[model samples]
Target: MLAPTTVPMPGLPERVRIYEVGPRDGLQNEAAVVPVAVKAELVTRLVGAGLRTVEVTSFVRPDLVPQLADAEELWAGLARSPGVRYPVLVPNVRGLDRALAAGVEEIAVFGSATESFAQRNLGRSVEESLTMFAPVVATAREHGVPVRAYLSMCFGDPWEGEVPPERVADVAARLMALGCTELSLGDTIGVATAGHVQALLDALAEVGLGVERLAVHFHDTYGQALANTLAALQRGITTVDAAAGGLGGCPFARSASGNLATEDLVWFLHGLGIDTGVDLPALVATSTWLAAHLGRPSPSRAVRALAHQPSPS
Candidate 1:
């Protein structure tokens, strides 16, 4: 088991890259459609909070994900920040076409680590999905849009009992070979443990895949996201995907919860002396705003605790 307290031997970067996915991933699963103007404002707020990489929205079919039906409008409407990189998810060639038309700079493609999940979620076998993505990735490269591939269900799958470590490593290697500049491994249902995280990392290393190009996306469904994230950090994995207000859940997967809250992750990083460049107080306020907009309480424990404390006057 990889204990969170097991610090890296030495020479790891002190700061980490936090890819904020609240505006996109977090809001997509909401029951009510957040207005496009509100979405743009949310992105602006995240940028002001010092997030350098924010996933604005996806260029998916409106019929598929009605929440992101205004993808093009959202992308065109947002106040673009010079420093932040906004990446949108593109499922296939048609999705890539929409993204290209919207002037998207960076695009993300997703595939599952298990064949069953891939078939169910993507309507294709794992190998077939990769084949389908080859042209999409190639086309994106030609257009000078960097691609980041997401390997879902890296830890566990609802259909499959336990996904093997080798399976996750194999899919990640394939995505990297397919010209994905970076790969984000997702614990889609948030059922992963610290030991499972280390085992997967060791397996990936065995296949010559370095941790630098890897990112971890964990859900707080089982209250293990932060601990798993720490395990990844201890293994030299620096990039992490978090959602503001801890908003988001898989529509297809039942009983799934939100991704690791950005506020919570920021708190963890701050305690470790790692600088994320995000304003903790401002982020807490943003989380509060989002929760109020959704008519729910803040899902982030850190944000909730901070909300109750007396503010510095």
Candidate 2:
């Protein structure tokens, strides 16, 4: 059997990529509609805090996700930074077309590991949903725009409990074959444990899918996001997706909580002596600012802890 190759084993990269999804995933599920200007400012502030890749928004039907109704406007308001990426989520061909017209350089497509979640969230069977993304991916390839893939419900599904890791690996391999430059495995219901994470990574590796092409998106619903993230890091999976202020939940999965807070993830990364090129203080300030617009206190423990720290006089 191949030995476990986790972090600190010359496998983990010293520099990790934090794909900030706060602007898109976080806001898309918010109850209140976020103004385009505020959303644009949130992206700017997060980038100011050194987030190199921020998902600005998704291009779903406005009737379905009103929070991100201003996807085009938000994109228009953003000032592109050299060497920075702003990827928007595109579900199908139409969404991809909208993204391309907006001059998007990179975009992400989402699929589900389970059929039930796919039907609930994507309105189709898992197979059919992936089929829907084929043309979108092909079109993006023609335009020289890179595509990242997301597989939700990788761990457990509300309707189908205890999903097999092989199931996720199967979908991951297919997504990679479908022209996804990177694949993010998501614990949509937030029930993934540390053991579950390592097992899944091992299964993925068995299929010739290494950590090099993978990322993780975890929710703090059961308070296992950080622990699960540590397990992923130990496996040398460097790219982690997080939401600033921990501000998000699955509208399709109402029982699920928000994502792992970006501030919280950054705090964990910095404590491990890993470099994310992010300023914790600056990130916390951005969350605090956004929290006010949302009319709620920031949900990030790191942000709250830092908020109490005495500032330099």
Candidate 3:
């Protein structure tokens, strides 16, 4: 067992990468159809905030996720920032086709760590899902498009309580073997604790997986996202997935909340002297703008508190 103090907390990395998922994960669950221009502006502002890895949209069928039906139009409209990598979620071959047609160079595929959640989310078994993605990953490699695979419910599942660490590792290993360049472990329902996260990392290590290819995505439903993130960082994991204004929730999981707010994560990282390359004030401004457009108050505590402070003229 690793001692708490011995874990290398190393004062945040020199340059941490933040993958902004607001346009895709954040908006997909919303009932309202956010205008394509609004989505474009949001992505633009995120880029202005220094977020380089933004998930622009999902290429799923309109009948399934109607919110992202304008994937092509939205991707086409965005001003591509030089050096910024814009990736879209592709559920299958058809979605990959659409994303490629829209000129996307990177894509994400998803599967769940639990069987029941996998069945509910993808309507297929875990093995079947991997089989489905085998060709997708191969094709992506063929076209020189990198693939990021998301293993949802890695810590805990709503349908299946307390997912085993070994199960999460197995799924991650399979996805990595399938040619996924990165594997994002998602605490889909926000039920993970620091101890649980450490245990999961230990299990992954036991299977010879390094923290280099791993990223973490956590929800703050239980207010454990940041704490769990810190634990992952101590274990040497770098990349983090977050949404602006805390604007997302799992459509299949009841009462589930969004991924950790980007502003809050940036603030935490800054306080720890980690370099995320993001401008907190600009991020706050963008989060506030997006919250207003959604007709909802900002869910990010950092954004709300910063917005009320008078700026120096």
Candidate 4:
């Protein structure tokens, strides 16, 4: 088997926790609905591949994202493994209710940095959307469930191009104030550059949200996800959000591409002599398996390169 030469990078974390979002974010944009059984199996395979945190499904309205309409059934069918964290996306109080009833251990709520995205994705203004999430976050806290808040378009917006870093920081501060435990900054359109990534992190830090409580979720639309991620890592970020096989794009934001692939991230981290606790070949095999189910070749460069390699005889 071939692998990147290990060259340690200075000032990088020794380990990174990859938050796998394939089953939810990846398949949610697919036009064809994936079976619940396949979804369950995909989650299991990702965990087996050594991904510690896997986001399984979302509790959003079924009509909105028909691909995830089987959230309850999928969660019920999963033969969850011990010591692996499975979080579900909950859009509103109603979504949170469904997740709690299904006994979800963790939940995430989606917010937007710009007013346009807030209106388009959540059907409300920025303030209105955060207002809606307050009680959801509060209720989840009351139930002892930790909530992760996703603030999309932290870099640029399709409708409102070039979001100000200060504005992103303000939205981030408010979301943190809503009793959320962690925050994932999303490059929804994949328009962020390395400098922009650093700037956003600095802005968040200025608002008292340090790198420890933050995660980076970059899309590869313009092929800058990896560079942006490196910038975040250099800034002391230890959590990254990626999808197996690069399987997801935002349904609401059509310009967005699939997320930063988990395999690719693992490859980069390993090359830098950083520990991810992921089995590279196993992660690639899992993506290859998922690509077959989706009837498309994976967009992940690492998966494509490694999945076709001849096994050592």
- Return the TM-score for each candidate structure: 0.95, 0.95, 0.95, 0.99
Q: State how far residue 101 of model 1 sits from its true place (Å).
A: 1.1
Cα RMSD for candidates in order: 3.7, 4.8, 4.4, 0.8
Show where candidate 1 strays beyond 4 Å.
1-12
Model 4 bad stretches (over 4 Å) = none
TM-score of 4: 0.99
| N/CA/C clash count, model 2 | 2
Model with the higher lDDT, candidate 1 or 2: 2
- Local lDDT at 165 for model 1: 94
Q: Encode model 1's per-residue lDDT on 1-313: one tens digit a residue.
A: 0112323335445898999999889998987899998899899999999999999888888887899999989988888979789999999999999899889999999899998888877999999999999999999999999999999999999888799999899888988898889999899999999999989999999998889888999999999998999899889999999999898977778757999999989888876777689888888888888788889899798888887677556
lDDT of each residue in 21-46, candidate 3, tens digit only: 98899989989899999999999999
* Model 1 CA lDDT for position 168: 91
- The candidate, 3 or 4, that scores higher on lDDT is 4
Q: List the residue pairs that clash in candidate 4.
A: none
Q: Who wins the TM-score comparison?
A: 4
Query: lDDT rank, highest first?
Result: 4, 2, 1, 3
lDDT of each: 0.88, 0.89, 0.88, 0.94
* CA lDDT, candidate 1, residue 18: 96
| Native-structure RMSD, model 2 | 4.8
* Model 2 agreement with the true structure over 173-198: per-residue lDDT tens digits: 88788888899999998999999999
